[model samples]
Target chain A: MELSNIEKLLEKYFEGETTISEEEKLKVYFTGEDVSPDLEKYKPLFEYFSQESTVAPTRNITLKKNRKSWYYSIGIAASIALAVGLFFTKTAPEPNHDLGTYDDPEIALEETKKILNMVSQYMNEGKEGLVYLKEFENTKNKFIK
Target chain B: MKEGAFITLTNTFKDKLFRLAKRLLVSNEEAEDATQEILLKLWRNKSKMGEYKNVEAFAMTMTKNYCYDKLKAKETGNLKIVHSNYQDDKPSLQRQLEAKDSLDWVGKIMNSLPEQQRAIIQLRDIEQYTNPEIADMLGLNETTVRVALSRGRKKIREELLKKHNYGVV
Candidate 1:
């Protein structure tokens, strides 16, 4: 009520001695339309606190936008990685070598020579059979005569 | 605890937890994230919440710790201050006309205070917490709480007076 008492309370308040109810009283007293000139300097501090009590914090638009972008960026990055992996995996072909290169050319030529020799032997055997047939026919004719 | 009790804790403490996080982190987005994190933590530790004698205070303490950890991470990483996207419904023309003066500057000034001092003021003045309760929440001695609050108020007063060029009796 008295200015000195109010001053003491203010001092106690600064010292964190005032209870919630006392602080509320101070808020009420200081917030009056007719604040004394002597206490005018402290008015802003109390006003700040009072105003702060009601001041809704500004919404963090950037953070929310960032979060959305973060998810999108991650999705894009994952897709790009997956596409690169698929391209590399699907487009590449397995290496093949010709087996003919591993064979000896001399060995192949010798095998061809052996096959030709076997064909000549078979021709000679056919000629010999024809000769034996002609000799048997002459012997039969002589015996019949 | 009972199902109803968990729901009651959330209902009762959501705004208070949000306010505390907002004050400590000075960003609505961070506060919301911090609130959700705190709530999740509470849900995970619901049994512990039930065991506490003062659930409100415990929840407040949890919120403060979570916000403080966020602040520390931001500082260590040198993260930029990110803005929030949450929209507020516009007030009516009459309400806007009747609105008080802008306190944004005041909030900035309060935010300029050291983390510990700012937290102490938030708990003591804004949250209407007693010194002992605040000390318990902050893991500081009650004397430290008083000192921080006193010093914080003095700094706030000095800053406000310097800006306004007025002397208190």
Candidate 2:
């Protein structure tokens, strides 16, 4: 292509109107050893783009392994935690509160008697107070008559 | 797509995905991670592959999205562009050094561009994608893509011109 054509292409290129082929031509011209001083400045820009496009990652990636590693570890940890939870839940002993009770039948009877005696003593004190009330009622009845 | 067909399709575009990721993330390891993740996602959803008219474009879109998300998630402040360190086959050692230096300058200029503009230039110039295709991948109108591309190229060109005239590094 003529230098005139290259110049026109560069103008269009800067305007973002050049077709892909025209851009290709520009790249080829710039990449050539004999680039004119007029357009030589643009060579590095295209060369940079060309070089960048060819960049394949140096490291090889295993899509399956790398993608799954973290999730897989979490999944396994979660399942283990759940399993341990279920196992502990199933095996946990039932709570028992029977430690404070008397084991001997005689001792149990003696404690019940003590509680009943205390209850009767309080009841008798109330009964004694009622006798005074009976006498007061009798006197009032006589007055009314 | 069938499994076999899906594998073939992925193989064809995996390099493109890696390159796009590398361009955006500016790190090979992160780019490789991004590519692997995207490919795995595509493989997992191979059943829905038929829905997309342009799978390559769709994959490229996924790569762009994933790389952006990665950048957002990263906490590091000083992310630098990783040059593929591509050395041209110039004959003279001095010429080779000069070429490397120029390429490095261009890389820095590209790194300084806004993310969207940088992506537009990468897709349009390096990937040789058509404007419409880039628009599709970027979720922008074709005219918007063109304007951004123009702006990006003009900025780099102006800088290069300045350097050429002033002989400044």
Candidate 3:
């Protein structure tokens, strides 16, 4: 790469007319130590661009970290949410469980019959006392006659 | 795209993405954040990635837009240079200092550049994307891309020449 060629390329570069290869030639010439003094003013500009290119992110973005199975992650997250929802819904108290109501119709019917039978037996005892009172009233009526 | 293929596609250019972000946003932390976001955004849209002919250029375009939005939102900040790879073992201390000064100066000059020009120079010169690729990434025709790039390069050169004449070295 002659200095004349580089000079022409440099002019072309500032004009935005240089080919990519021609721009590469300018970067190559200027980054090396042996630039002619006349082009020294432009050295820093080219060197700045090249040097800037060498700058990688100081902290790695850790593509590896992000590359983990995102699908598996999404699946785990969804399952956990569903599990939490299910647990809350299941553990919440319901109104009917505390009541002593029977679930089976046959058992409910039998229990109802037994309760009514006990009530009728108490009623029959009271009615027998009333019969004694009726006999006492008949004897009183005979004495009055 | 498959996960494996998507990862490979993005892994190749994450640094370039970061560099472009840093170039436009002028902050390492912000640039890193922007890179992460853009990559994640790419991942979220990976289903649609197959629709494009060049995913790399698409990603670059996204970063350029993201940074422009950020710049519009944050209208003020100083230029901060982060050259992690430039070594400290220069044989002569003065030469190294001079290089650093020049870099700092260039960084400031670049900071004042219009966002479009900054993006153009970053894509074309540093990333070495073809002019057509750059034009496509920026949503501009080839002529506008060329005009902005040369204008940017000329501005930097003009500033460098000014510093030289002023005995700033």
Candidate 4:
């Protein structure tokens, strides 16, 4: 391409009017060593643009690594909380052994006495069976005599 | 979109996304983080990726917005010159040093450009995006993009000319 043509393209480029092909022609001309001395000043600018493009960020960026995936963590956390809640709800309802007892001291004492008397009466009945066994043994002894 | 298609879409424009991030943030690490962030967003929205006509442009716009938010959050510090690729091995050490110096100057000048202009220049010149695409990415009209590009180029040219006595024998 003629130098004048490149000059025209550069003008359009500054105004942001150059088509992609025209800009390509400009980059090609400026990148070469044969540029007219007057145009040498514009070379670094184009070179900078090209150089800037070639610059890959020094590190590889893997998107998967940086994704926090908090939803999964939140799901696990919520499930654990629910399980613990259900366990506490199921096991925490044991009634106290003191339930159904009278609150008045006198009434409670009377009830205790009644329970004790019932236990003693049952013991006396058990002793009466021993007395019958003793009479039977005596009758046997008299017959022997 | 399917997972396979999502990956393909990302692979297609990942570099452009990274470069745009790098350009805006001026830090490779931040740019890498931004790119990963943008890609992850795209991955999550992979189901809706098909809704857009131009995924590449959409990704670029996302990066632009993300980097801007990061800037607002004060995540990136002062702009740093990252010119690792501008070196030429064939040149003499002295010429290489001179070129490096030139690139450093350009980087500084680029930093000095207004944020919008800087974005416009990078999209138009470095990434070779069309004016309409750049307009969409920056959320500006075509005329505004052109004006910003013009102003940015002129400033760089004027500064370089002042420094080097450009066009002098």
Candidate 5:
């Protein structure tokens, strides 16, 4: 191909007007050993594109493996965290007593007074029953005499 | 999509994703990291991936977005820069090996370009994507894509020429 034609193609290329096949043509032309001197400067650009198409660093397989392992590590860490949270939440005991109310002196005093009142009531009832039992015993003795 | 379908999509596009990231980030380590993160995100949103007409395009778009976010995060000090030390000087390397030097230069130039231009060059030049496809990926009008690509190419050519006296030489 004429150098001028090649230059025109290059112009089109820079204008983003070349088709894939034309681009490939430019690559093959620039990559040839006998590239024209006038085209030498643009040589690097075409050569760069051609090389980049095939010469990119291969996907680092080791990196991929490391990533797989890293993911596994993250998965394990997340699982452990979730398990610990579940264990703590599931096993922790519920507080049944309302200690907050008893923390007030007046409430505690009222509770104490209620307990004392119940005790007095039971004691009075017991004393009355004893008195009735004593009366019954005296009446029975008089009848026997 | 089903899990298996999504896995298939990921498996299918992983290399492309890596390539795109590598092109964008200019570091293999960063590219790998970006690819993994992108894949994980795709996997997480695999169910919604099916909503797109083209899964590969969707994957590419997602990869680009993720790379942009990573770039921003790196700028904000939320991410660390991981360098790759792989040299092209291996003895057994082919004549195509010299091509890598050119690519390195291209990568540097692309990195120096504005974000939109760099993306246009990546999709149109490096990835060989059609203008329409690039438009879809970038959500720009096809004419806009064409204009951006032209401008990007002209800029790169200008740089290459200024550096090496491209055609005048």
Candidate 6:
């Protein structure tokens, strides 16, 4: 009678109709000592399932601590420190325009020549006008005297 | 999810992930590494944990997908070989020596099964997940899960019975 009950459960189990409890019953019966001679072949199936489930990961899992709030605070502090540092660095230095200083001697010489040429050209133009002014002043003084 | 909730979730499902990985990959080092990788992924997505309705199912799905990808990579010879000192719980020597015993040879039958069937058997028989949960993990409907499970289970039984009737002992 008990053998017939196991047989029925085994049939249902193969058909995938056995509930968790029914399956548990089947497992208990199959793994127990004195399984029916007719049902001896089914013992390993249950034994394998039960044994396989007990297998654990031998390596220890190393999960990092979340510390979400702690990390958030640290992040905020770091950002604030960065903002403050940036503020000081930005304000401490006055905005200075480039005066066109050249470190290279060749570049300096070229720039000096270009400036001197511009100055000489302006001076010559001013001299030409001054010559006409001087002639006008000399004539006016003589005639008036 | 709460801060503590993510840790709690990983702690609960890590073993399942490892077991599922082993079932799919059939190697201990690969399974362990796969579990570690899956947990790391879950940790990276911890903020989105609340988005999943069933976190356990979601984690199982991830583990399955990761193992499949690993298997594919392995087939293509694109996988970097992972080395580890950890050993798997192999079938015992006595179990192997008992040539007449039908119970001990299930592992060989399981290994011969197709990947999908093996996965279904693992999730259903060993892990004891409901058909619906197995469906969600494998991305199949309940009916498909049931049918495949029945077929796989029956095939395993038939193979066992074949060995018994032949009496190799």
Stretches of model 5 off by over 4 angstroms after superposition = A55-145, B1-12, B78-103, B166-169
Q: Which regions of candidate 3 deviate over 4 angstroms?
A: A62-145, B76-100
Per-residue alpha-carbon lDDT of candidate 2 for residues B1-169, written as tens digits (9 for 90 to 100): 6666777778887889998888788888888888888888988888888899999999999999988877777747657677698756533565335435888878877877888898999999998999999999999999999999999999999877765664344
Badly placed stretches (over 4 Å) of model 1 are A54-145, B1-4, B79-102, B166-169
DockQ-derived CAPRI band for the predicted complex in model 5 = acceptable
Q: What TM-score does candidate 4 get on C-alpha atoms?
A: 0.69
Per-prediction TM-score, please? 0.62, 0.74, 0.66, 0.69, 0.63, 0.66
Best by TM-score: 2
Q: After superposition, how far is residue A52 of candidate 4 from its true place, in Å?
A: 1.5
lDDT of 1 by residue, B1-169 (tens): 6656676657666767777788888778888877767666676687666578887788888887888888888889995767588655654454343323325545666788998999888877776778899999888999999999999988887766555552223
Best by DockQ: 2
| Residue B23 lDDT (model 4) | 79
Candidate numbers sorted by TM-score from highest down: 2, 4, 3, 6, 5, 1
lDDT of each: 0.75, 0.85, 0.85, 0.82, 0.76, 0.84
- Kindly provide the TM-score of model 5 when superposed on the true structure, using C-alpha atoms: 0.63
Judged by TM-score relative to the true structure, which candidate is superior, 1 or 6?
6
Judging by TM-score, tell me the better candidate of 3 and 5.
3
Fill in the DockQ of model 3: 0.43
The fraction of reference A/B contacts recovered in model 4 reads: 0.72
Error of 3 at B45 (Å): 1.5
Model 1 lDDT, residue A9, Cα: 86
**Which regions in candidate 4 have their CA more than 4 angstroms from the true location?**
A70-145, B75-100, B166-169
DockQ for each candidate? 0.16, 0.52, 0.43, 0.44, 0.26, 0.42
Give the candidate order by descending lDDT: 2, 3, 6, 4, 5, 1
DockQ, ranked from best to worst = 2, 4, 3, 6, 5, 1
| Model 1 chain A lDDT-worst window of ten | A57-66
